[model samples]
Target: MNLENTLAFAKRQDEADELRDFRNQFLFPKHEDQNFIYLCGNSLGLQPKVTKEVMSHQLDNWANYAVEGWFDGNEPWMFYHKELKKLIAPIVGALPVEVCPMNTLTVNLHLLMVSFYQPKGKRFKIIMEGGAFPSDQYAIESQVKFHGYEPDQAIIEVFPRKGEDVLRTEDIIIKIKENKDEIALVLFGGINYYTGQWYDMEAITKAGHEIGAIVGWDLAHAAGNVPVKLHDWGVDFACWCSYKYQNSGPGGISGIFVHEKHFSNQDLNRFAGWWGYQENKRFKMEKGFIPESGADGWQVSCTQVMPMALYHASLQIFNQVGSFEKLRNKSIALTNYLEFTINEVNKSLGTNQYTIITPQDPASRGAQLSIIASQNGKQIFDGLMENHILGDWREPNVIRLSPVPLYNSFEDVFLTGQALLAITKKILKSS
Candidate 1:
């Protein structure tokens, strides 16, 4: 697609889009009777129209059945996760039995680390990407300390090359090889939050396995943004939040994946609770904890009906589109077009005022473009907000614009480009 900066070009692209109707399913925020062009799905997703109806139906069930809703409803609360795991499995590329909807991302990470982060005397270090999301840093730091190891000595961070903006696959693999004997766990975000770099999961998993270590991923940004085969990649464990790309509501239910190979391993320690006990034998409530088969065994508490209901509303939307493979094609195009638009802004100004820190290669990133404006970055971001264009700002002058394929259109990108040009010009002229 030869790109154009005109509004007509953008409208034509939107007119031909197959997924255009799906955009109507979401309720976008508005100011002064005009809808904002929302490009913040990487931070928070728009609410789906079906979410309210689903929530109301669940509320009705609560009013009618109350305590009996656990077993009496059309979708019983006791068995609801099975239905969700079926929907969630394909998103992360795993068997239905290998995935579970449970606690939030960091909470799930902590629970999984309790089982996967076992360390002996020598091979006790955890290797990860430098400048990970703060939650991951805090979680890993506490886990190592719980095992009686100093943070500095127990955690090895793989950084990008001196002049580069993202980590190299070979450099990451070399880091694993360098710490082969002492590396107990290899944990990384599937797509880095700040740089928007998608790591080679299969290569990293193979590297970790070669060195006799467990590999895991925190797919906070990648789960619904890109396609990944955790099962085929031999990734041992993974977790993600559904609120961002999945469009379940804010603080939505999180998901975890433990490969089928680990399901029957009784030696893996977990913080057991009654809900994880064998379902058929649960009411008997007798002696020791005998976990249910598959990933359901990791459950720590009873079902959360409302959150699952909200999640179910969005999962049905994904089910309508079928899979991430369907969305990936459009994702690459939207991100590329946005990148091109940013470059055009700099070209028009005859200077490199806007620099995209995200990798230009579509394969190395998802829908996000992390932009750093050389002048008045914060002012430019605020201008977009005032103009009914909703992107998000990170600390230290990074403005992230994520053009989600499911809801965002090419016209949105074009209009955003126009807004950026006008804002930059106005800010520079006034200064």
Candidate 2:
């Protein structure tokens, strides 16, 4: 598609968009009296209009049923997550039984490590991307330490070649093979949170399995933003937070996926809780832990009803618009428009005032474009906020803007570009 950088073009695109009406379903933050052009879905999504009503329904159930809410009520607390599982499976490309909603992102990562990160004598290292989200870095660091292994010794971090901003697939695979004997687990984020590079998950999984290592992914940014076939890719386990692209509230519920192949492996370790017991036998309250079949067996506690309620609100939108095909198409177009608009900014200013660090290929990224302002970077980011354009700013100097297809319009991108141009012009004049 030949991209244009004008408000008329953007409004035309939005007007012709089949998914345009979906934007009306969300509640956007206002600046003065106008809505802010929210380009921060990679960090946090806007609240769905339906979130309040659905959450209130759960609150009403609590008031009406009290302690009996577990068995009674429309969405029984005992099995509330069951419907959620069905909603989540397609989004992450798994069977309903292979996925379960529970815990926070890092908590689920730790729980999964308990079962998957069993390091034997010779094979005792975990390999992952170097600049993963801080949660992953902290979680992996602590997990290795808990297992009585030094963090530096037990972890192999694959880094981008110096001068490059993203990891090449070849470099990652070569590193995994180099440590084939010592690497017990291969862990990676589905998409690098900062650079917005979507790794070749299927290729990485195959390489890990070929080296006789268990593989996993933290799909914090990729779960709903990009396509993933976790089960088909033979990824041993994976987890994601619903608050970002999925549009659940802040610190919303997290989800997990365990392939069906791992279901019958009774030797697998887990920190069990009452909710994870086999359904029929749970009420009997017996001694030994006979785990519930599939990923549900990994649950360490009962559902967090309110968090799940928030998550369910978002998943319902994903479900209503089956097969993320349309959303993906729109996402690609929106991101491309954003990139084109940014380039237009640089061209107009004739100084390359903003540099995009994210991968150029649509296949290698999702909705986000991480840009570094040539000068006064932080000030430029602050300017964007003051002008009612909400994007994420990383330390040092990276402004991450994500044009989410669900609620974002082409006009939002156009307006953001307009604001960015003005901000850069003002900053250049000052300095």
Q: Write the per-residue lDDT of candidate 2 for residues 1-431, one digit (tens) a residue.
A: 77888889999999999999999889999978988889999999999999999899999999999989999977899999999999999999999999999999999999999999999998999999998999999999999999999998999999999999999999999999999999999999999999999999999999999999999999999999998999899999999999999988999999999999999897888888888999889989899998999899888788899999999999999988877989999999999999999999999899888889999999999999999988999999999999999999998789999999999999999999898999999988999
> Which segments of candidate 2 are over 4 A away from where they belong?
none
lDDT score of residue 192 within candidate 1: 91
Q: Model 2: clashing residue pairs?
A: none
TM-score of every prediction relative to native? 0.99, 0.99
lDDT of each: 0.93, 0.94
lDDT of 1: 0.93
Worst 10 residues of 1 by lDDT: 317-326
- Candidate 1 TM-score to native: 0.99
> What's the residue-level lDDT of 190 in candidate 1?
95
Report the C-alpha lDDT of model 1 over 303-422, residue by residue, as the tens digit: 888999899899999999986787999999889999989999999888899999998888899989999999999999999999999999998989999999889999999999999998
Full-model lDDT, candidate 2: 0.94
Write down the RMSD of all candidates, one decimal each.
0.8, 0.8
